[model samples]
Target: MVGLHLDDIDQRILAELSVDARLSLVTLANRVHLSRNAVKQRMERMERDGVIEGYTLRRGSGPSRRVTAIMLVYRADRMRGAGVVAELARIPEVVRCDILSGEFDLLVTVVAESMDRVGEIWEHVSALPDVENTVTSVSLSRPIDRP
Candidate 1:
């Protein structure tokens, strides 16, 4: 909706929420120099207008770094139903999954604490009923990352 209009206050509210969604309405109101009720009304309007769709969690620095891997999955039946997707969702390590338009049917991104854990997830994916085969590659270094 390119035509959607957002005033300066709405922009400031979005900026603050992007930095820390946990900020209370009172704190946000103070930062935006508006009454608590005013801020609440603006936020509610943004939500209703779909300017603020939802909030997401950002991963914090943990003691152990996570290993990342990409798995290219080949399905036997070409994902006839939602069963395959449902099963993949059950695996927490699977961070992202996308349907591809090539030899592979699905591309899945997985993150785990160690190589062993990544391997375990790979094994689990390989054993899924709909999965015929999977080609996996572990990420050694990320030269560029956005978001």
Candidate 2:
């Protein structure tokens, strides 16, 4: 907590919310020794101050029916701007994308309902204007996963 602006109560609020952002105001208030309205005001203030960015669902920990694949993309233009990123964001199956510094320009994680859908996504990505080549690896099993 050194060099940080958060007080003890604010830190506790963030800590509790990190574990369960859906916690009701009453529960949070009881945990933090505050009224429901006080907790709500603190949360709202934190959100406004950018101390809390936004809540997100942590994936890959629960049971899923989807298949996941990693695609290594070689872009012809080498990510000239946000065009490729904007396009990637449009694809609902593209869970994550990273710019690389090796044989490929981008690494993308695709999750889909079936192998057929994964192939379709691959084709769609390859057809993008900036993409030159791609290599896809399907994840068969994950023995070690942090999330």
Candidate 3:
């Protein structure tokens, strides 16, 4: 199938939505300096093109802080229908999952309020069918997300 061409205005709208998906159409219109109707039309087109799918709230606060834990999940074999990797993707605790190229095939970064929650994930996910092994690493601090 052919893809839609993105002009400068389309790119601007896409970038703004990426940074702050919660922005209302009126707010986005004002920020982009386009008429509300015009902005609405552009946003609608983007949505139809599968560019803007949905909006989400940025959650969490307090000293508890969000924790990022990396998990290495090994499978019985690589071609067992994604095996543990697909199973891990179903977990809400898991935020990011990637197919690694090494001794392990799945690398997952889980976000939670405490280490206990992270451990719970390891216990449950590692015990699933076709899982060979799991190695975990807890992040001390995030240097990139914040200044």
The true-versus-predicted C-alpha distance at residue 27 of model 3, in Å, is 11
| 1-147: candidate 2 lDDT, tens digit per residue | 123355557766775675567899999899889999998998888787776789887666566667889999988888577567667755657767789997888998887867999999999988988888999999999999873
The superposed Cα distance between candidate 1 and the true structure at residue 77, in angstroms, equals 0.9
What's the residue-level lDDT of 92 in candidate 2? 54
lDDT, candidate 1, 1-147, per-residue tens? 355666657766876675567899999999889999999999898889877888888677865467889999989888566556656655656666788887998998887767998988888889988889999999988999974
* Alpha-carbon lDDT of model 3: 0.74
Score every model by TM-score.
0.57, 0.57, 0.56
How many residue pairs collide in each prediction? 0, 0, 0
Q: Is 1 or 3 the stronger prediction by TM-score?
A: 1
RMSD after Cα superposition, model 1: 10.8
Clashing pairs in 3: none
Q: What's the lDDT for all of these models? A: 0.80, 0.79, 0.74
Any runs in candidate 2 off by more than 4 Å, and if so which? Answer: 1-63
